[model samples]
Target: MSFTVLLEFQLKDGVENAPEILREVLAQTGAFAGNEGLEVLIDDDDASKLIVVEKWASVDARNAYVAWRATPEGRTVSAS
Candidate 1:
């Protein structure tokens, strides 16, 4: 089955490097094989906050991505 992944992030105070981060994230997502697509939306109340949404073609694909994100770096990324 297909799956959708939604990631919400709040940038640290004065973290004005959203563009660079977005580029990096986009690169990572693109490098992955199972990404159906991705969408990034800015929060209306906080410009520094964003939501990254992804669509996958199957649960296997989504699960693989989740597994990838659950690594040490993923834990760090998910923590804050």
Candidate 2:
């Protein structure tokens, strides 16, 4: 079965063009193993609020991806 993950983000003040930044950052997420698709939703009333919808092939696949994101390599990517 497919698995879905929803991540919400609240951008700090003076963070310009959040959607563009999120698109760039989430490129890696879309390319990650078992990733089926990804979508970003911005709140109508609050532009600072964003939600990331991630679809994965399975629960195990999602767990594996999360585990990998905790590693040094993943941390490096996240830091970029």
Candidate 3:
């Protein structure tokens, strides 16, 4: 079965381009193995609040992705 992951982020004031940055970061996420799809949701009353809905092929796939994200290579991609 498929798995879903929700990630919430609260941006500080003055970060008007946060969505654009998220798009750039999500490019890598979308290309990762076993990633099915994803969607970005913004709070109706709070633009600074964002939620990322990620779909994976399976729970194991999502776990593997999370593990990879903890590695140096994954950290580099996120830190960029």
Candidate 4:
């Protein structure tokens, strides 16, 4: 069965470069394997709040992506 994920993020205080940082991070994630469909949105009521929606073919695919990120030997996603 297909799986969907909705991730919520709040921009750090005084993050003027929030958009650029988000875009780069998303680009990197989408470029990775097992990422099928991805979309990001901002709350109309709160611009600093962001949501990322992803649709994957299966739960395994989604788990694979998470595992890839969790490993010390794997890609090191920026954490700022």
lDDT of 1 by residue, 1-80 (tens): 66788889877775566567667767777567788888889988887788988888888877776788678764322212
Mind giving the per-residue lDDT tens digits that candidate 3 earns over 2-77?
8789999887777666657777768878998899999989999997788999999998888888888788877632
- Tens-digit lDDT track for model 4 on 1-80? 88789999888887666778777767767876667888988899988898899888788888888887688755654545
Could you tell me how far off, in angstroms, the CA of residue 62 lies in candidate 3 after the best superposition?
Answer: 0.7
RMSD (CA, Å), each prediction: 3.4, 2.6, 2.5, 2.3
Ranking by lDDT: 3, 2, 4, 1
**Model 4 regions lying over 4 Å from their true place:** 72-80
User: Each candidate: what lDDT?
Assistant: 0.74, 0.81, 0.82, 0.78
Model 2: worst 10 consecutive residues (lDDT sum): 71-80
lDDT of 1: 0.74
Higher-scoring candidate on lDDT, 2 or 3:
3
Distance from true location, Cα of 36 in model 4, Å? 1.8
Clashing pairs in 3: none
TM-score of each: 0.70, 0.80, 0.80, 0.77
lDDT of 3 at 27: 86
